[model samples]
Target: MRRTDLSSGARTQPPSVDRAGSGKAGPALILGAALLGLGLGAYAIERIIPRRPMLRGRVIYRDGDYEIRDYPAFHALEMSLYGGREDALQRAFERVSGADRDGERPAALLDPVMQSRRSNAADGDDTGFTHGRWSVRVPLSAARAADCGFESVDPRLRVISVPAQRVAVLRFTSTEDVAFGINRVMLEDFVEDEGLEAEGPVFYAYYGLSRALPFGRQHEVLLPVSP
Candidate 1:
């Protein structure tokens, strides 16, 4: 009589079993802590980087020229597009800083100069890129009276003495969420692309209005020119 070999037919042993009961809790906790620490460290590094607000000298174009205006300039521009009577710009500033105090949002201190609103331009232009948001073009120099343009201005131009200064500028579209980390990366790229140095508080020279420019359609980046 052939005896049935039940042992042979029994299920093959699994390759491995977690009998230690050590469970994933310890390792998972450790991993999660590590990740948390890593993220915090990265954020700390980002904040620790030195960022100062430098003055961007005179800015001019074929259309017109602009001198350095005070923070009031920014407030004015913001108010124009936002509303009247109330200080909505100040409110926006508070929101941006996650604070209810002044002197927050360092980038706001840079001031707005030439506000040029561009219609949607396709391809590289990417105008009206970030809704109808404005794109700024500020000039930089040793002094306001100093030469700010590419070179000598044409006969049709006039050089006016404005508040001259140095600055680290950036051009970015508006966002419901501002990601400093990504901004830092893009800032590095922009500096390299422009052959300029990164001396940044990250200023935006808003050209037009925000509602006009759509996503990836607006054109703005930090300008890291020589001091």
Candidate 2:
């Protein structure tokens, strides 16, 4: 099983011994151990630092179905990939996550970007995917954006600017592990009831990675609102 750090969106899978007599752990194992070390360190520092979401925006209004949030403009590095959501996440993880281990270079981490995604096939499309139209985005701080040296990862990843905007957000948990995509009715309802206009590319922010079991696993969808 893969575990994502709650404080930082670092992916950690359990360490496993190499079966080929290499006497070395795999990248996943090394990454896991490194993150475990950092997680412990962060736990100690959490006592002195604010422990809320590093990317959390201000909640301005709420009527039950959804809440209006005021989000300041933030820079993000987005990568569109031709794969399932998990594949995109893993690709994004291997590329952008802040981890140092076993001769592998550590990614820069001033403030770790929140792991967020937007699937293009949200309209009940049973097909997995046809083209490279889906995208995965990691919201980055200005510092991280400036220090980004991710030249060795996939070539398709690129940075994009996200303007300051208000968003209507909905929180929910699911029981299915592999299912994804924004709930159309909830988004539409929020848009209609709140009288808020929305733009394109809705976002999904998983509390942990979306691969976790559905029950009590928290995640949210953010619809960009017209300012």
TM-score per candidate, chains pooled: 0.26, 0.58
What lDDT tens digits, residue by residue, belong to model 2 across residues 19-131?
Answer: 56445567768989999987777665555443223466899888665778888887676666565555665666556552211245333332222334344454555533322
State model 2's lDDT: 0.58
TM-score of 2: 0.58
lDDT per residue, candidate 1, 1-227, as tens digits? Answer: 13355778854554554446568679989999999997777566546643323433344221112121222111211212232101333333333223212242223222233333333333463322334332223322233224233223223223333322343334445542244235545655655664656443344343322222222322233433454
Candidate lDDT scores, in order, read: 0.36, 0.58
Model 2 vs truth, CA RMSD: 17.1
Q: Which portions of model 2 miss their true places by more than 4 Å?
A: 1-53, 98-132, 175-182, 210-217
